[model samples]
Target: MNPAPSHVASRRDKLLILLTVCLAAVLLPLALSGGAVATPAIGRDLGGSPASLTWVTNAYMLSFGSLLMAAGALADQFGRKRLFVIGLGGFIVSSFAISLAPSVFWLDILRAIQGIVSAASLAAGSAALAQEFDGHARTRAFSMLGTSFGIGLAFGPLMAGTLIEYFGWRSLFITTGAIAAVAFMFGVPRMRESRDPNAAGLDYPGTVTFSATLVLFTTAIIQAPESGWGSPLIVGLLAASVVTLVAFIMVETRARRPMLDLSLFKYVRFIGVQILPLGTCYSYILLVVMLPLRLIGAEGMSEMDSGLLMIALSAPMLVVPIAVASLTRWASPGVLSGLGFLIAAAGLYWLSLVDFSASKTALLMPMLIIGIGTGMPWGLMDGLSVSVVPNDRAGMASGIFGTTRVAGEGTGLAIGTAILAALANTSLAHRVPEGGPELSARVAEAAQRLTNGDIAAAAAALPEVSRHALSLSYADAFVGLLHVLIVITLLSAFATFAFLSRTRTQGDGFERDEKGVEAVTRA
Candidate 1:
């Protein structure tokens, strides 16, 4: 490939910037989901328990989601190019370091560091794109970014399976590190430096308090399934989350220059944009994290087979966002977003009806429908979220949007797993009522294993007569969880529809201030 154009002044330079920024976006999800297919192998090799293995994913998410706003604020204060290069370098180093981690503890710690660095890269990279593009070009640039993100998510499992089969799980990190290093090398000299000239000093107190709130809350959610929800530790963590949240709000309110401008919440349009991603990502995460496990464990498919099947769930994401962006001339973004949520809810409802004994092909239509629906709003919402804000605070808006996306995925995974575990246990108890105390213990063990996507172990642990029943119970639990998700998604769809219905035009609900910066207002 030829060298990337030197600066953003020429048309070719603009395309290069988009590609560079999208490279970062793609790398984030690639690093995140690349390990999905390798999780079992990692656990087996590292001697990690199911609960501990989950932290391997959650640790990355917790740190990534928690630091995004602060990272964005820093990017705005410092130059975006400077922070982007630093973040890319950190990601490269941490990715390499993770491959050398001797145990799960060190791996999780390194993954958390990777997440922190990823936050900086994502926020700065996105801000750079926003700075480099405008109008229709901006729309197309965001669409391409969304497409790259979808491609990463769509192909991560396939890549992971192939890499792990050939080179082992360690290669995943090594490959990612090498890619980041290359991107950094190109990004450093070619990328133009940009920062908010009016930005004040970093809001250290607000960042600390806000980060504590997210950490405590996510920790409580992750542990609630293992430790009883009513446990003192869980309760204390919940309480601490609340306290830190209040402290964060107070700090932001009093700060001369807040990390997050709390006043943005007053805009109904901004609120709608924020909620759009949270709702869509919740459902998307469930599919991404759970579907592969379900195929491998419940359906007895090979990792490669499962990865191929996942294409139905993610390929539409690659195509639909660009298509939706093109439709902007015909439909308002609010209309498109609300319709997307409704369609996704319908898809989830359809998925709830699939029979457990059905073949993998039976999942294709619902998965495709859900993928298309999920893709429809992504680029639209992403573009609007940053564009609606002042040009200088684009980083802050991008950070908030990215934070919601990661936080929603983490929250969904925790809740979905808990629901599946609880429901499976309940079904097992009902079906095996006559089993002795030992049998009851065995069934509980099996349910836990099933929740972790070790359906083979779960089945093997049960008596022959109970094995088929266990499969049915697993199916029933999944269906039950799907029903719950469907309901939540439908409620979100209704709210999105209601919010959008109030607007008369594409930008009717927002107004430009005296300085020509957009602000949210009533239609």
Candidate 2:
């Protein structure tokens, strides 16, 4: 073949940057969901108590979500390319170390490290694309990036199940490490370095306060089910989180160059765009986190079978981004996002009607509807978040967007899990009222086992009569939780509709003056 023209070569290089960064982004969620499917096998091999296994997921989410904004600021102040390379290197090392872990302790520690570094890679990679691409190219780039994320989420379970069934659970980490290493090799050589020239010094107090607040808040939520919500420890953590959050706000308002410019909140459209991801992820992604466990434990499906069923939930995301991107020419982003959330809320309502006895086939239609609805706004929200801000602060905007996304996801998981645990325990107690302390203890143990995706072990721990009752309770609890989540999602959809509907179609601008920030006239 003839060598490509210089212009063509330049285009290819830009595309290569997108390709490499997207690949790196895929690794985080792939690793997350992959671990979800393989949790049973991992617990069995690692021999951890049920509570210990929960940390495998919680640790990663807590670390990843909390550090996102700080990482974004660091990338903007330093160099994006440099941060991206370092993050990738750290992720690769953590993955490898996790694969070689001798115990659950090491695995959890390494997973937390993976989450921390993944934040750096995600923020820098997103900022890099936003800075490099513009106009329609920016739209297309974000759309493709959203598709890549959807693909990873959609296929992660299947890949994890297959790996666990044949090669063992360790292979999941090994595979992730290998992929990150390849991305690193490609990215370090061709990636163009960029940073904000006017970026100010790091806001140390703000970073500490913000990160500490998230950590404390997320920890309390994750542990609320085990330690009663009103327990001293939970209350203490909640109080600390509130105090730290206030400190963060005060620090940001005073800092010469705040880690997150509070002035961004003045743009109504920016606030709406940020809320879009949080609402969408809360309604849609939480299902992605819980459905696999439901299938394997309550529904008595194999890991591979559960993974296949999850395709019903994830498959629509693969194509919906491109479809929505095209639809934007006719409809405003607000209309599309609002309509999408309404559709997703409807899907959740439909799912709430499904009985515990419903088969995987029965779930297909509702799951597909939810997937389509959620996917519509996925890429649009991401693009709007960066577009509304100055290009120079793309890194910070990207970080904030990512922080909301992961934080929303983590919060949803915590809330959903808590509701499930509460309802299940209540149902179980009612069913076995006269069974005595021993049986109640066994039932509690079985519930924990089920949450960890060990259906067989949970069943074996109970009498046949108790087992049947337990399954019924689980089903009832799941249906009840769905009802509660549906209400929350509907309210969020309405709020999204209200705010987004008010936004101007043409882009808006921001101007910083000596004393105050001004919103430029919309074009």
Candidate 3:
């Protein structure tokens, strides 16, 4: 054991961490900007009604959210390093398949495959951090991981927009595939086995039931506007969703190794900790994704211009890592989360009253303000969620937290769409009076066209007066979305206040050293 080759030893110790960060970074652009840029191209080549393009993103999200918990459990049972490598490989293959897809159906299949692989990578990345680092190294390791998430998120839109403009939308997948392939190769050899040999096996039955429940619920929400909430499909889907979800709960309670631990919620703080991620992540996706479309499609701005405007959304989070790391020391997590929510709500309220006809400058101010508010609590919420759980259950705690975040994001998108759809319908209907039956019918058709994602057709088919009126309706609908956002933010604030428990600023009695470094002691 004289001198273990210094370079090899150092490389072995750090290879897993480096690969994990790279794996996590690949997920962001795929999840964030791929759909926004690909929608038009996918719809055109595939020949589905323009409205079907929404499914491009919906398909990925549905599978991703549904399988997240099971994937987490799998990573903990098997080895994270092993699973991460496999996941990266699958993602690369699926991405290439999607790039070559001849139809929307094939593309959708590839997208679902991509979702499953991406979910596994995300789950394994968390456990890999725990396995690779100890003491203060773990703290710094996690911070680096968070930094990866932030940078990947910020870079996504810009990268996607440039690729789409210069080459084509498929470049999005090709690029992600290449990066993920590199990560897998670098990760396989040096990555050590870290899974607990004594850990319980996978819960297959619970996984199936829970996955079904999520798929059903998400499908109902997404189809409600299109199929009518009162339709049998919608009603049956919701009913089935509830029954399956309850069954999942029962199965988890009895499973030897449950994907989600039912007992974790008993800690009041555990429940409260879920709110911050839910609110912030939900608003972040809804606003950032929707704003680009609104600015480019509706406001007549170029894609580059719209992308530039949206980049400001990440500005608040840019300086937030240190602030979040420090804020937990000054007050309880509950108070900090509550303050963050209140600030977010205020920003949303300002957004709700936006003068749509005014300059874009007015809009950027609120967006930046909201970004600031949203960024403040990301880390503390994460800290609190994991802080309440035992060390052995770290993987489980992360699973539950990720599930809630996904659920919240799905719910937000559905709610935003429903509110906007209703406003658009009502506004259009009111302006075109039924007294002029023919004109009224034409106006209604135009409104329907707009909802179906056929903007050009809608404008061409409408009368001059009705064209002006429909624009007003679109404006009104955007306002409605802002109001809904404000209400949700306030609700999140109240929930954080009510549920999050007070914790000592130093976090679980782990004091900082004389140099002011807080060691990552076991929870």
Candidate 4:
């Protein structure tokens, strides 16, 4: 037989490299999104406070989100394949361990470990993938990784719901672990080792400061409803987060080899690329977690029903490749991304107008619209992350972009949960007429339980209030939340367009040569 063309062999190797990372990508969302679908069920099985139940999801995100930049730096300092093996090894162990957690507290701890390991896996895998591809081939590769990620989000809920209903919630983790293990077996041998040659050492000071900032910020958000936003603890947390964030910036600026190059912010288009993930955090990620809780908790939908509804919201991701191809052909990325954000904003507005009493199907159209809009940017953001930076700093690009996306998700989810709970508490405030401090505390606790879909517990706490009344209060708060989300989405759309419209061939001040060497260029 005739030997295969040289290009064909090269293409096959690239595909194999991509498949490994794509597998790694899918696990992040599956654990986050699919794990979210199991929250209510998990809560029912292992009774805990609403905050604890939220932590079931939040713990994984917080740990994963906070460590991503450090993980990226490690991948660069070490070898990508080496980090990949260590991370996956730990991840596999944590997944099975989390399945056996006897209480919410233990589950939270194990999930946090799972998240940390996942961060290492994702950042290493992504940076490695970027190293292997160049030019348009790289764009297509990242797009495919994005699509695999979308697949995990789009189907996670449905799979979790079905698994929880029949096999129990533990089955979700077991299944994810088994699938991830299989991917590890198939892909590891094929993945060539890669790393950033210019990596100076791990930026310990920068990593510590950055990690502290997120922990403090997320803590403040989660504690605001209970401690009161003005409480000293919450005030202290917010203040400390700001201080550490400033410290991180100062450290990065002074360091010879910063984990994030502060100079990149000078480029208008690079700033816009960073904003893309921030937009999705509010527009898409928050919705994926919030909508399911609302469906099951407020509307009393079954696990299966909520899962099907989420499909409408996330299913548009299935067409992300087609959407990217068509939209990019007809318009510049600025137009495509900006238009997508506006579409999502419109969907949020339409959702706000929807009556709670309307059929679940009433949510389908707007949810689908929101998904389509956000899906437009989903595939492009990953490409833009590395494209804007120099070829050598691909590791930093992966770290910074991944941090923004994951950290933003963790931060947004905390804020969304707090705001929604506060709104519910406010709605219930009038109902607690003639109450003292003790009663007020009870009301606050009940409000949290109600938002988490634990109506049975909330009703017990407020025996005088009917379950229907509690549901109505939760629904009222949800509508108000939607209005807030709409405003955020619109502002994001305007900012995306304004910043991205000014893109240069190199978003920053670097140009690539035939061998992927980078040199400084004036903008």
Best by TM-score: 4
Tell me the tens digit of each residue's lDDT in model 3 across 179-268: 777776676566666786776767888878888887787777766655667889999999999999899999989877677888877656
Q: Write the per-residue lDDT of candidate 2 for residues 1-523, one digit (tens) a residue.
A: 6556877977878888898888987887887787677667778788676656766776787788878877777888899988998888999999999989999888888888998899889878888898779999997887677777888989888877777777988998999999999888876677888888877756789878987887788778767665668889999999999999999999989888787777767666667778787777667877877787777656767777878888888888888877887887787777788888888888988888877466568888888889888888775787777766566666567667777788767666666776777787677667654777678667666666666666566677665446667777778878887888777777777877776764534343445552323433221
Candidate 3, lDDT over the whole model: 0.69
- List the global CA lDDT of all models: 0.76, 0.77, 0.69, 0.81
- Best-to-worst order by lDDT is 4, 2, 1, 3
The number of the candidate with the highest lDDT is: 4
- List per-candidate RMSD values in Å: 4.0, 3.6, 5.3, 3.8
Better of 2 and 4 by TM-score: 4
TM-score of each: 0.88, 0.89, 0.88, 0.91
Global lDDT of model 4: 0.81
CA deviation > 4 Å runs, candidate 1 = 1-18, 130-140, 386-399, 431-445, 456-467, 504-523
Off by over 4 Å in 2: 1-15, 130-139, 267-269, 355-358, 386-398, 434-445, 456-465, 504-523
In Å, residue 229's CA in model 4 sits off its true spot by 2.2
- Tens digits of per-residue lDDT, candidate 4, 206-271, equal 888988998899878887776777889999999999999999999999999887778766555667
